[model samples]
Target: MAVSRGCLCCVKYLMFVFNLIFWLGGCGLFGVGVWLSFTQSQFSSLPLSFPSLSAANLLLVAGGVTMVTGFLGCLGALKEQRCLLMTFFVILLLLFLTEVTLILILSIYHKELDEKAKDDLIKGMKDYNKNTDLKNSWDNMQKIFKCCGVSNHTDWHNSTGTGQLPSSCCRPGTDPCHRWEEPCYEKAKNFLLSNITSVLVFGVCLGIVQILALAFSMLMYCQILRAEKYMD
Candidate 1:
């Protein structure tokens, strides 16, 4: 069955929001990448849980690139420019690719860190054996570690005391035998790091969908133009 131009226009109009948001979100993600590229310290804080500087740096780069490309996509959407949308799609696809790898690295790191921390606490406890405060201290250490699960990295203090410091564990090697190796809420921070990748992936995928929609709309518009010329 033949579709009327009016019907086609209605479909495109309905898709407008989809196109608009895809570009806007894409741009924001790209901006993050730019910010990370400029500030080494911020980059270091990122992937925020990975020990390997390389992994952290890579995530930062991915983020910055995604952010910039995404922002450009937003501009293209606003302008309703086809070539620009295509360019933005390429960058968005790259962003998705990087995000996939980042997810793998993150899973590996999280598992490894969890094991290492458990081993460290166990060994530390054994070393303190026979010190009358040993059991109490170990128990307290375990408690502090558990406390860390609830907190975020930003709240952790590099302090010997957990007093008023959120997520700051018992100062490691110190008595009451407490210490924080990283910031408090190490788990939450790791979750946050991984969460970004998940979100960006979903966003890029949505952008892809929007691009497909735009492609169809552009094709329809071209067809209409051709049909009008032929009739004339």
Candidate 2:
């Protein structure tokens, strides 16, 4: 009986630590989402249609849900509350299933998604001057991603009537950098594709953690029920 009690205590504390980390991760996601939204709003006057806005919104929603569930899990584990633990388990299970489905869909339709993303990037470039937000976003993408037009630097020749490329296409430390020599579309596409594996790994790790948390919660719930029955 003493060993069983000790084991239960260990599980309870482990769950508490896990939930705490989960809560902190959720908060971080929420902060990033809010920052993205605020940044986008700064260019409200521009007719920019950010494709990433939906992703930011999703991060916000997912973060909020994770935070709430984390809190419940922590509290229920500490207090040995069957109801709260069960509730946490159910929510975690649902989230895990949703994430799995998302991963599967993304993996299956990655080619389609990649083409759509490329098209959107090209469209944004075409309208870069039409909207301040789009211009800023494109400039940032080019500079940060070290990319230029959708296909190549020549892609910009058709878009800009002045036959001048944005300074972002120029290499650093060069006063008159040859923008025509630098092509961004292929680089950008490669960069994005390279990160797909990392993203999938991250998702799989998170799903595994969720499963462990769900299992721990169920175990604690059952223990609570057994203890109550023994006492009666």
Candidate 3:
């Protein structure tokens, strides 16, 4: 009933290496989360509807969970403990399910999500002159994207004035600040959709890794249990 020495050694080492990589990735994510939270603290003044705040918070939670799962996986493999291995397996299963569910939800709600995002951006725009933090965030976004407002330069008319636009909306060297013609929302959407393939690929690869980890943990767990019973 005992696991063969070669098989056990191979699985143990593979699990260790995989979890080590996972742990380091978690560390990188956590660092990025901290950096985002600090740099974008200005976004805090905006309503919870703003996506920037949510993104930072999501990264923080995801990073912490990843670090914990990686630690459990590594420890379970090294120690060859059934309890730890089972726990690792359960956590990986849950993560895999959550990822799959999220992908499905996003795919189904794409349009709704788009509308919600636009609405939130518009609401944020209404406070442009009143909230410095929100104004700065929007300025940075528009300037970097070379975009005007949510839909077009005219989208700012209600907030600013009939004829005026924020300086960020304009291309350089215009005496009257000719505003960029593109909309921020469309630019951002296109940017995301253009990169969607890479995102999906990463998610698929991560899911595969989770599956392998789940299988390895369960196989090792059973082997350990058998070994224990044999010893008894």
Candidate 4:
């Protein structure tokens, strides 16, 4: 069947919009990842825990990949280049598969992952004062999360050998308050775990978008091939 000119025009416009959104999202991710990487590098001298550092590095990689793929997709869609479209489709498909696999693995080993994260947080807390960046990071987390230590306030004592807690552990507007009884670990952990669903949802949604883009690209490529044949 012959593809209508109107249908082709619509597909072209739709793809342009989709690719534009994808490109913007990629840029945002890349910018945030770069920021995190720079922040992490500043604390290289500290005994930063692997989980935190690894997370930052992962962000950088993800951002870079997203940006490159987004550019390819935009270019392919705009120029109607079959080779670029195919390349975009392949990369998007691979990313989709990888994301699904990662989700499955994470679901299967959530408990172990949680425990590992706990250990890393404790280690980071123990070496917090060793580096300025580490100290600032810990303080900011405590302040923002309204948390104290990995497991409890006492964890700070066990980890730092210091009887006094950082002021950030105190509740806001009560700077002089001496209530070290509050534990931050549970709060921080809960906060993080609560957001996991949203992240997963976003990833799944993005994967679906990629699938649509792949299908559109492939269809358009075929249409282009047919058009060229008709011309010849």
lDDT of 3 at 177: 84
lDDT of 2 by residue, 57-101 (tens): 766887788888889889999888888898899988887777678
lDDT by residue for model 4 over 92-140, one digit each (tens)?
7887687678779778987787677678777777777776777887776
lDDT of 3 by residue, 1-232 (tens): 3346567778888888878777766675576668767755644564444444555576677678878998999999999888898888888788768867867877899688767877877777788988888888788777777999888777788656657788889898988787888898787556545634553565456557677777778877766776677679
TM-score of each: 0.39, 0.70, 0.81, 0.70
Between prediction 3 and prediction 4, which has the larger lDDT?
Answer: 3
TM value for model 3 = 0.81
lDDT of each: 0.48, 0.69, 0.74, 0.68
Task: Sort all candidates by lDDT, best to worst.
Answer: 3, 2, 4, 1
**Candidate 2 TM-score versus the reference:** 0.70
- Report the number of the highest-lDDT candidate: 3
How well does candidate 4 score on lDDT at residue 93? 81
Candidate 1 structure quality by residue, lDDT tens digits, 108-210: 7867765564444334333333453543443343353344422332222222223343222454455563545443235434544564576467656755755
Q: Which scores better on lDDT, 1 or 4?
A: 4
> How much is the lDDT of residue 26 in candidate 4?
62
Task: Give model 1's clash tally.
Answer: 20
Query: Which residue pairs in candidate 3 collide?
Result: none
lDDT score of model 1?
Answer: 0.48
